[model samples]
Target: MMKLSMLCCPLLLALPLLAQAIDAGPASPQQQETEGWLLLQSRNLAASPQPQTATPTERELALQRWLKKYRYEIPDFYDPDAGGKVEVKK
Candidate 1:
């Protein structure tokens, strides 16, 4: 019938698009965050690397002093058992 053919024609054309939309739904928050970090890292890597210096610059020294004076100590509690237990020497 012409009506059945017309109805199926539009649906056949749209089925693939509907399937794509369902399959490629919105990215998860963590996936989006990881993608953002990956983009940032790629940009940083693409830039020319700065030369390392034996001595700190005045700006670096000043920043270090400020951090030493005001920065709160970050607790080092991440992956405490990562490498298994270490034997302590007396």
Candidate 2:
């Protein structure tokens, strides 16, 4: 019984190693399609132009309107630039 247990123990340990050796080759068709879709999406995202966002002046004006609507007192230190000259780089 002792000798049988020793032999069986090694065989049981080797079974998992043998299972891992079996290769399931290439990815499935669904997996390949999913990968291709992801690649296309990434490429499209890279190629697309950035959406138009609010400028500093527009943001400031929005904030001023919000403050007025809420009836919140503007702090004395809060100096807003109303139509300030913005330097544009050539």
Among these predictions, the greatest lDDT belongs to 2
Candidate 2 Cα lDDT to native: 0.80
lDDT of 2 at 44: 82
Tens digit of per-residue lDDT, candidate 1, span 8-34 = 999999988886444563379888788
Q: Which residue pairs in model 1 clash with each other?
A: none
Q: Identify the leading candidate in terms of TM-score.
A: 2
lDDT of 2 by residue, 1-90 (tens): 999999999999999888755456437888778887788898785454767789999999999988787785657685567548889999
Candidate 2 similarity to native, TM-score = 0.38
Steric collisions counted per model: 0, 0
| Candidate 1 segments exceeding 4 Å error | 1-7, 16-26, 45-90
TM-score of each: 0.29, 0.38
